[model samples]
Target chain A: MERWQVVTVVVAGYLLLTLLIGLFAGRRVSASVAGYVAADRQFGLLAQYFVTGAMIFSAFAFLGGPGWAYAQGAAVFYILSYGVLGIAPWYVLGPKAGRLGRRLGFVTQAQLVAGRFPSRSLSLLLALLSVAAFVPYIMLQMSGAGIVFRAVTDGHVPFWLGAAVSYLVVLVYVLFGGVAAVGWTNVFQGIIMMSVAWGLGLYIPIHLYGGVGAMFERIADARPELLTLPGLNAGGEPWSWGAYSSAILASALGFTLWPHLFMKSYTSRDDDTLRRTVILFPTFQLFLIPIFLVGFAGVLYPSPPEAPDFIMPHMILQTGLPALVVGLFCAGALSASMSTGDALMHAAASIAVEDGVRPYVRLTDAQQRLLMRALVVVVGAVAYYFAIVQKQTLVFLLLTAYGLVDQLAPPVYAALFWKRATTPGVLAGLAAGIGADLFFFWQRDLRPFDLHEGILGALANTLVLVVVSLFTAPQPEAHATVYVEPEEEAAGATVEAVA
Target chain B: MRARTARRLAIAFFALYALVLTYPGVLPFNRIRPLVFGLPFIMFWVALWVALAGVTLWLTHLAARRERRGR
Candidate 1:
């Protein structure tokens, strides 16, 4: 068989397995809101760990990790910084969120914030913003799947078709099983990705440069700057330590605010489980080092006349490895993309249902499940459209999503930790941060003080939140207290309190 | 305190150490050469941190089990 033919069969077989797993997981779904959204909060530590890991690994790990490593050299360390700073805050915040989620039966982050502030409109607005942010993020994952398919198949199966095939598998299972399907499938995909990543990380460098150290030495001899911190383009006015550090900080702080990640906190069995997952998350980060090595190898071997994102895939293809090994590598990349896509698809659907639809219409348990399934298809379709239309570098698209979605952090942080944080304050902060981020991103000439656009936006957002919240009366303690109490305790309360 | 809570705290501390020790910019040294496990000093340190996380979790689970029996 031709290489592309082999690639098609392997990728198709992988998708079939994902579909099978999704269908199988449908048996576990309970016929209630909890079952549809949070897997009835029964996910064990291992399951939660894998799902969280897979959620983050996404296309960024497969494509952006190596792409940045190849293009920017040592500056790619900023990517690693995220895992460190990101999970620490989650140890405290995620448990609190989880506890509250259990107490209030909240399905989405917007619901949590809205419930805390006693503002239905704010929840609806956040839902809208989350969907907008998630669409671009989902697009990046779909586009990544497209890139992988195109590369492996030598363009025989076009990007859209490849994306469609994988997404079809995801939609089939997710539509039936909901969060159960997403969580279980993520476990399978996460294992495949981590195993393949470590195997490739060790094997590729050894095959290329006799050993890992030798690979570094070869790159050092050829282009010494590639191995050093601050990287080659440092003196260029566009990049700086201030910009890099601030960007890393913003990414770490804002990471938990993503609606999908927030939802994961709700799925944990308890506070301890959430904490354990955060602690073990670095093991996932350790796997990325070898993936980064593939990009470093690119410094020794020049990229062909194609996109820079193609460098890692091309390196894997040209490694003279067996066809099965190459197929497995493709599967790993696919796993990364699909795992992320499934989570985003589920989150987007839940946001639409719980936050978007619930306020307007009284939805029964069965009706909510039906609505979630339909919304999954809708979210997938929107993302598929962007994947087909917008073909940009994965890094650029990802950074833009990171910058925009990060605006949610101020409100999220305030809701959890600050009692004085009011609805109007959150609204003002979100507006300022999102507006500044978009302005700076679109009009590059207008970036104030040579900082990352995200930093400026975050600062403006924080300032508004502080000033506005100080002036505004404190939110009713009754509104916020519901979230902090245990579920059984809160369950005894009258419906009027929740309403 | 519940054994589970203690175990969780241990895991959190281990994760915190790994976060600080492995961060690229935070680390003061570059290319410390006397290797462990055929990896660089920094990589070795990180691997130990990862292992420590696992060990801490195991210990915490044991403590939690013992506490449960006492209760």
Candidate 2:
């Protein structure tokens, strides 16, 4: 059969399997709010890790990682650096977030912040920001599926049709099964993704360039700049280090702040589970080193400037490998993209219901679940529209969300750790940060420094939070106790009732 | 909570990471050697720290189990 035909069959089969699994998950779980949002909080470390891992992987790993490495060389190290930074902070924060979430019946990060501060407006604002930020992220994943479809089929299957077929499966499964389906599918997808990553990471290098050492040696001989730190495209300025380092810092700190990642904390069975997951998460980063090798190989291929992003797909095609192996590779890429898209769709829907709908309309457990399922379609369609329309670089789309998500952190950190942080202060700070980020992003051409627009926004946000918090009256001591106390002291008794 | 101890540990870890990241340049060129598993000495340390964290978490889990039993 033609490669495109093989691609179509393999992709269609994967989607069909996913839809069946999702429907099965829906039938298994009780149709309650807890079942829909938190998987009834029954998830253990293993399931939580897979879900979190798959969520973190995204299309960025399969497509953007190799693309960036091909174009920028060693500068791609910043991507892995962010992963490391992102996972490390979870050790302290994840447990605390999880503990509070369990105790307060919090379903989203917005709920956690809003409950703590007693500010419905702040919660609604965060819900809006989350939808706004995640829309582009969801779009990027859809676009990545489009890119993969176009590549494998050689443009036989249109991009929109490919995205529609894949995402419709995701929407069906996620709408039916809720977090349980998303988590279980993620486990299956995560294994496939990691195995394929390791296989390709080892195979392509050995197959094409003899071995990793030889691959690097050949690239170094041809383009010595490819292996060096700060890399070849360091612009003309020495101050690029500041920009790079800050970008890494912002990404690391900002990653855990994203709502989807934060929601994973709620899935963990205990504090120990959260810590175990964080400690083991770095192993996934080790898998990424090989994908970077594919980009390194691109140096020899000499890609066109306008089409650097397609280098990895082109390289994969050029291998003339068996259709089965190619199909498996495409399945792995789809896994990475769909896993992320499912989580984003679920999170966005939950945010709409928990933070947006719950405040305005009193929803029963069943009604909330139904509303969430409906919102899955709504959110997926909104994201699909953006995916079809927007043509920005994946990195640009990612950074835009990262900036807005980072704005959320100052308030979150304050609410968690500091007793003095007031509701008005957090609300004001968040507004300033988001406002500044949007303004700077619009005027990106005229920025004073080469730093990420988010960094500037974060600084303004932090300043406002500090200044306002100092002047405002503190939260009552009783209210602050909920966040500061240990899990056993705060929620052990209550959690037992639910369990 | 011992604020000073946590603060100190955080600072020490940050400093250690910074040194490890920059150590290739700090060391004499002739003295440096690629270590076990074909990774550079500095890169090996990154792997080491990651492994250490895994071990620490395992130990913490054990401790938590013991505490649960005691209760």
Candidate 3:
């Protein structure tokens, strides 16, 4: 058989297995919205861990990560830095949020925020912002899938067809199986992605340039700038310490705030499951070190790909590795892309139906499920269209939006820890943050020691929230304390039981 | 393994990780002249912290588990 045929055979087999996993995992799903959206809160330790890790790593970790290392060198370390710091805070927050979720029956972040603040308008605003955020986010994953498909097939599969095919499988399993589909598939995909990544990551360098050390050592002798800290900025100029430092901070702050990921609180079996997931996340984050090795392996090679993001697949193809390895590499890339893409599509549709539409129009459980299923299709189509038609602009938008996610940090912290936070204060803070984000984004400028636009926005958000909340009478102490100090509620329950 | 202690451990754990990512920018750990384990000083520094983070969180998890049992 021809080499491409072997690749086709391997990738085809991988896709079929993904579909089967998707279908098999949902056998226990009950006939209710909770079953569909929250996986009946039954995820175990390992599944929860992989679901969280695989979702966070995404296509970016597999494809874009290597691309960054190949192109920007040490700059990619910032990606690794933010992931651990960002998720560590979840250990404190997740169990508390999960307890509150059980009590309040909130499955979306907006629902949780709105429940605390007691504002439908706030829920409406959050619902809108989530879609705005998810569009580009999901599009990024789809575009990654498309790029991998086109490159792997040597353009036999065009961007549109490739994206549509992968996402078509995603929508089917996600439609049939909600959180279970996402969870089980992540377990399977995470295994494939991590193994393929480590194998290829070490193999390419050792085969081409002796080993990881030799590759970097050779690069240091030839092109020295790539190894320097606060490496080149996105524009290829020497990155300032100020900008590099804040980008790392902003990324960490924004990491867990994504509504897509946050909604998983309702899916955890208990607080311990969520906490264990957070504690074990660093193990998953370490996979990036190998991914970066793959990228750095591409440097100083006489010929280079047209773009940094293409390095992983390009090197795989060019190095003339066995067809089996190339095929596994393709599956690995697809695993990364589809794993995250499915979750994004799933979350966005759930938010649209539960938070956005249901509040405006009352719907029964069956109707809600139907609407959410229909929305999965609609949302996927729109993102797929954008993925094929406008890849560059959407990715640019995604980069800008990471900072905007930091805007959620202030309100979330208030809900979890501070008692005096008010509804109006959060609204003011959110608006101020988004406005600050836009102003800096349009100017393409980092401000105040080159802190990320998100961090800058968050600073403004916090200031507005504090000034407004102090002036406004705090939400009644009883209402505020329910979320602010859930431990009190637990103690009250114990007291009642004793009586 | 008091719950309070486990909570504090979690906080300290992240604080140490943040310091590694943050101080490196200010202090500039990017020297490649000396390769530790075939990685640049900065790269090795970050990688070392990642492994340390795994060990740290694992201990915290154990502490948290023991705290639950003690309760």
Most TM-score-accurate candidate? 3
Docking quality band of candidate 1, CAPRI definitions? incorrect
| Tens digit per residue, CA lDDT, model 1, A38-134 | 9989888988999899999998778878877777776666676566556667766888888888866887888888887767777788888889888
Give one digit per residue, the lDDT tens place, for model 2 in A1-499. Answer: 8887886788778778777876786677767887788887878888888888889998887788887777776556667656755666777788888888887787789888887888788989989999988999999899888888788788887789888888988988898889989988888889988998888877777888877667666766676554444443424222255455556667876888899889878877788888778768877777777777777677786444335556666777877777777777788888999999999999999988899879878878778888888999999998999899897767658877888888888888887888788888998999999989889889877655566778888889989998998899988887787776655345665887889
- Predicted structure 1: lDDT: 0.77
DockQ winner between candidates 1 and 3: 3
Off by over 4 Å in 3: A391-398, B23-28
The per-candidate TM-score of the B chain, in the order shown, comes to: 0.67, 0.54, 0.76
Kindly report which residue stretches of model 2 are placed more than 4 angstroms away from their true locations once superposed: A232-239, A302-306, A445-449, A486-499, B1-11, B18-71
Judging by lDDT, tell me the better candidate of 2 and 3: 3
Clashes of 1: 0
Give candidate 2's chain B TM-score: 0.54
Which prediction has more favorable TM-score, 2 or 3?
3
For candidate 2, the docking band is incorrect
* Candidate 1 vs 3: which has more TM-score: 3
Which of the two candidates, 1 or 2, achieves a greater DockQ against the reference?
Answer: 2
- Predicted complex 3: CAPRI docking category: medium
Residues B1-71 of candidate 3 have per-residue lDDT tens digits of 56678668767867867776774533656588688877777888788777787777778888878877887
- Fold similarity of candidate 2's chain A to the true chain A, as a TM-score: 0.94
Q: How displaced is residue A215 in candidate 1, in Å?
A: 0.8
